[model samples]
Target chain A: MDALIEKLKGQIIEQLNLAEVKPEEINPDSPLFGEGLGLDSIDALELIVLLEKHYGIKIQDPKDGKTIFQSLRTMAEYIKSQGKS
Target chain B: MDTITSYAHIKHNQVSVNGEIIFQSYPSLSLPEFLSEAYKALGVSYPKFHKMDAQCKLGFLCTEFTLNGTSFLTENDITKTAIVLSNAASSLETDRVHQHSIDDKSNYFPSPAVFVYTLPNITIGELAIKHKITGENAFFVSEQFDAGLLVNYTETLIQSGTEASVMGWVEVDGTNFEAFIFLAEKQKYTNKNAIFKPLNKTSVITIYNQTIWTH
Candidate 1:
């Protein structure tokens, strides 16, 4: 789980173009949206693409995005539960 | 006769305002480097400037310089200003960059950030959003600079009730790029002693042609 969260940080930084952000700066348990990463709706769409391209995890329901994308930890847990991580 | 009150022209590594050269750099600098240097020289911080495509960056920088000296107009009046710009490439260079991201499904990592700027008029949209302009806007793709078309269209808009217009040519393709933006308004002052040039096709052509650096 720790390894997965660390990988997710790098991927998120690269995918969302947080150019000045470093992997160590993102807290695994903190929120991914709003005040945390300050990501907007467009970044959310990119995150969905990131999930499909990396983990092959197709989000079945749009509502699931709210919980699954809550944090780097939650995203890693969701991917592991799907056995795709 | 409407008059062109202010203008900015940027070609090669040089930046000019109202036909006078203001900034120039070494010939070896790349487009991105030169634009960054220009942004720093402008001494304003708009973080979104760093994320823009080359076309938007060029248009943004030129608009900033052209309007920088125009403090006579209030923000409310400025918001009513219209923009009409022309370019040959029409975002083709940014299109190529975006295309490379989705060329192969195997290596594809399509980016929304890149995909958003694929349209040429998006440069105008960026300007509108940045400057809070809500007036009408148009972007033209042509084989070359059409001063007559620009002057005619801008005059029609101003005559139809647009307060003023910022019209120019901004072309960016690969390493070749140039921008010429000017402010146009109906002749409000008819004093025979006034020296400002009228915004006719010939004057527009001269302003654009003045930036041509002979190799």
Candidate 2:
């Protein structure tokens, strides 16, 4: 799980080019949107693709993404439930 | 006399497809390469701008060159100078890249870097920060280059009491880029109520070359 989280962090940094941010800077349980990371709608879409590509989990509907992407904890929990990553 | 007292342009050293000089300090480099060279020439080392979209880079380059050495205006003067920029492609390249990211099964995740550039007005934001220009700024996308629209916009700014106006057409895609800027000031006519008239091309060329107006 730790390795998976680290890998996700790396992908996030690389895709977003968050030059000022590091993997450790993102709290695993903290929200990825709003005040936590200040990411916007575009970032959310990018995250959705990241989840699907890396974890082999398909997110067919973007509307369901709101709940699934509420936080890194939720995302990790969802991935664990899917038994993919 | 209200005229373009000074002006500057930076184009790709290499001749572009239409024989138009695409402004760049380095001729051998592509869009990303030329952008890096432009930033280096301007002596800016900030990394925040490195990830900006192509349109933003073009707008920033033109605005930086326009404001680099002007001593007549200070930070306060920016609020009075209107920025009117026209372009042929209104973030089409950005949309293209974004669509590619979504369509390509292998690369389904669109890079945030590319997605942010999809907006046509992002360049305006970049210019505003570089020059601290908070005045009226607009981006117009036209099929072909429209010199009439450019002139009309500048005339409006002049009549509206804008102290100065920076107007131009900047188009860039892949290896193609072109930019032309004119800084204008208000002119007073003795016949105040006379309908505004546009000078002929020859007259414009003469006035541009000589920086003098003649009947």
Candidate 3:
């Protein structure tokens, strides 16, 4: 789980072109949107692409994105549940 | 015809406002690196600028400099300001970056942020959003700088309804880039004492050529 969370952090940084941010600074338990990473809608689309390209994960429902992408930990757990972690 | 009220020319390492050099780029820095440094030097803190493609960034910076000392006009009547920019590349720089994103079938990851900038006119949108400008806007693609086209279009917009126009030739491909933006206003509001050239094809072409060639 720790390794998965760490990997997701790197992926998010690179995929979003968050050049000023370091992986260590991204707290796994913190929110990925709003108060945490402060990413916008466009970044959400980039994250969706990241999931599809890296883990072969296709989120069927848009509503599920809120829970699945709440944080790095949540995303990792969701991937694990899908058996693709 | 409208007369030029303000202008800025930006190259890789230097930025000239009204034909006067104001900012110099570090020769050692790469294009991306120089842009980052230039943004810092300009004391602008817009985070979205970091996400923009090279063409948009160049246009944004050029406009910022063009309107630098004209804060009174920009702050008072932003809605009256229009933008008409022409370029040779027409977002080809961002297209290349976007193409690379989806080209690798094994590692395909098309970024939405990058994809949004695939259109050249996106720079006009960016400028409008930044300045709250709701006036006329247009983007043209030509083989080279078309002084006649820019002059005609800008003059028509000014004559029709718009009070002023920010005309530019913003072209970018990788590290090689050039941007020259001029703010043209009707003769009624122009100051006689101000050292501004009239908005005509010959003068515009001369300034444009001088900006690129002198560098």
Candidate 4:
């Protein structure tokens, strides 16, 4: 789980073009949107692509995105639940 | 009288405002690096700048520099300001990237962020959002800079109630890029050192050549 969380940070940074952000700076338990990462709708869409492109995990429903992309930890857990982690 | 209060030119390995070079690196940096450097020199922080594609960046920087020269937007009714720009390649640079992503379903990963900028007019949208400009806007695709078209269109817009306008050419394809943005407004100018030029075809052509044809 720790390894997945760490890996997700790098993927998010590259996929979102967060060039100024570092891996250590992203808190796994913090929110990925709003005040946490300050990401917008575009970044959320990129995160969706990142999951499918890198982990082969497809988000079956749109509503699930709210909970799934809530944080780095939530994303890692979702991938694990899908057996893609 | 409508006058071009200030302008920004990007070419020959430098970025200039009102004909004065503000940023340039000898061993020309990569396009991304060059734009990042130019954004830094502008001394303003706008996080959305990083997410834009190359073409949008060119136009964004051009608008930033020209506005830096005068209080054109602040002094005039921002909602009455307009943006009229032209480019040769359009958004082909980002289109190529988007094409590659969807080239094959087996290896497909089309990014929504990248896809949003596929339209050349998105550069104008970026400018509008950044400057809160809600007035008229248009994006033209021409084989070369069409100063006559810009002048005619902008003049028509001004006659139709546009109080101010930022119009010119901004192009980006692969490593080649250029931007020449000028401000046109129905405001009195008293800057003693201003390069007083009316928004006419001859004057527009001369300003464009000052940087584009200098190479």
Recovered share of real interface contacts in candidate 3: 0.58
Candidate 2 segments exceeding 4 Å error:
A19-41, A56-82, B1-8, B13-26, B45-48, B71-79, B102-116, B129-132, B142-148, B181-215
CAPRI docking class of candidate 2: acceptable
Residue lDDT tens for model 4, B51-163: 89988988999889888857787798989999999999989999999999999988988999999999999999999999899999999999998999999999899889999
Ranking by DockQ: 4, 3, 1, 2
DockQ of 2: 0.26
**Model 4 TM-score, 2 decimals:** 0.93
lDDT of 2 by residue, A25-51 (tens): 999888888877677687777787677
User: DockQ of candidates 1 onward, in order?
Assistant: 0.41, 0.26, 0.59, 0.73
**Model 2: TM-score for chain B:** 0.74
Model 4 Cα lDDT, one tens digit per residue, A1-85: 9999999999888888887788999999999999888999989889889999888878889899999999999999999999998
Ten-residue region with minimum lDDT total, candidate 2 chain B: B206-215
Tell me the tens digit of each residue's lDDT in model 2 across B1-215.
33443333445432221122333354567777776666676776554465577667766665566555655356237778777788888888788888887997766666766777788888777777766777787888998656567666766666676666666667776667766555555443233432211322332343223322111
Output the worst ten-in-a-row residue range by lDDT, candidate 1 chain B. B187-196
Cα-lDDT of candidate 2: 0.64
Winner on DockQ between 1 and 3 is 3
TM-score of each: 0.83, 0.65, 0.87, 0.93
Write one digit per residue (lDDT tens) for candidate 3, span A2-84.
99999998988888878778899998999999988888899989888888988999999989999999999999999999999
* Candidate 4, pairs of clashing residues: none
Q: Candidate 4: DockQ?
A: 0.73
**Tens-digit lDDT track for model 3 on B1-215?**
56777788888578888777788866667777777777877887776787788888888888988887675364435677788999998999899988998898987778899999999999999988887888889999999889899999988877778877888899998778889888887665345645477888987876775554233
Candidate 4's C-alpha runs over 4 A off are: B189-192, B211-215
